[model samples]
Target: MRYACPTPGCPTTAPTRTTRCEQCTRRNSRAHKITLVCGPPCSGKNTWVAKHAQPGDLIVDLDALYTAVNANPTRTDHDQPAALTPFAFDARDAITNRLLHGDHNLRAAWIIHSAPEAATRAEWKQRGANIVMITADQDTLTHRAQVQRPNQWGEHIQDWHRRYTLGHVDRTVTTG
Candidate 1:
């Protein structure tokens, strides 16, 4: 049974569970098509996934993870403490790494983030991710969030823009 290497640039297949040809395995295995979605608060990253994602497709969304471990599935309260964030990140990474290396059942995974760091985006791109960055002007984003959370949306949007690194996004969609 020959399995094709899922790595981005590798073109070999092998009869092994490592999902890599011998030569490719000498360095590392193939990477999976992990799509990372980024945007400011209320930029509709979740809406995009809800609109397009197929059932059974894995999604790594921080709010969803927070919901999983807490009672309120609608919001992540600010008072929930900083420790939970890192814990959820760990779980997300473990799932992503395992699927990237071993699982053939899933064609791809979606990761939702406000990831403004170039290094983080580059790391995901190198790991075979297609970045979908949804963008909107500060006023637009603030208006979108004002209906729900008015006090903090502007700051979050500013932080995201401040940390955003140009030239990292594979696909950019401007909402406003």
Candidate 2:
């Protein structure tokens, strides 16, 4: 007994009921796209995702997670106490791990991170993620930090620029 691959336009066949051919199976598994928006603090990573993301899309952002866990309903900014950083990080990791599984009901997943190392971007690529680097000049970022979070975010902005290295995924988006 033989079974034809159920995938449309796929001509492969198997001797047993293997739902789809190897090629189609691999392609299907990667149907859900994971996009990582990376850059320094105040680089508009969250804004970029907000502009592009649609309903049913999963968004994993540490700052947003932190705000949620902070449980401050009146909070209108991304600032969170340093004590809650670890907890927010753990939540982000859990969500990211689940997204990496490639079996979620989400249409797409967007992760906002400050990934400054080539190795980090390479790993994300290996896991079928698209890297989008949102950036701005150092002065602009520093100024934005000062205006937004003052002493809290300026150092992080400077650190990101010092460590960032353009990798194979050079989809850079300059933001104001």
TM-score of each: 0.73, 0.79
Q: Residue 115 in candidate 2 has what lDDT?
A: 92
Per-residue lDDT of 14-60 in model 2, one digit per residue for the tens?
55676776655665576438888898899889889999999988899
Candidate 1 error regions (>4 Å): 1-32, 72-83
Off by over 4 Å in 2: 1-28, 73-76
Report RMSD for candidate 1.
Answer: 5.8
lDDT tens readout by residue for model 1, 79-120 = 233557787777777877675564446655788888888888
Choose the strongest candidate by TM-score: 2
Worst 10 residues of 2 by lDDT: 23-32
Query: Candidate 2 clashing pairs?
Result: none
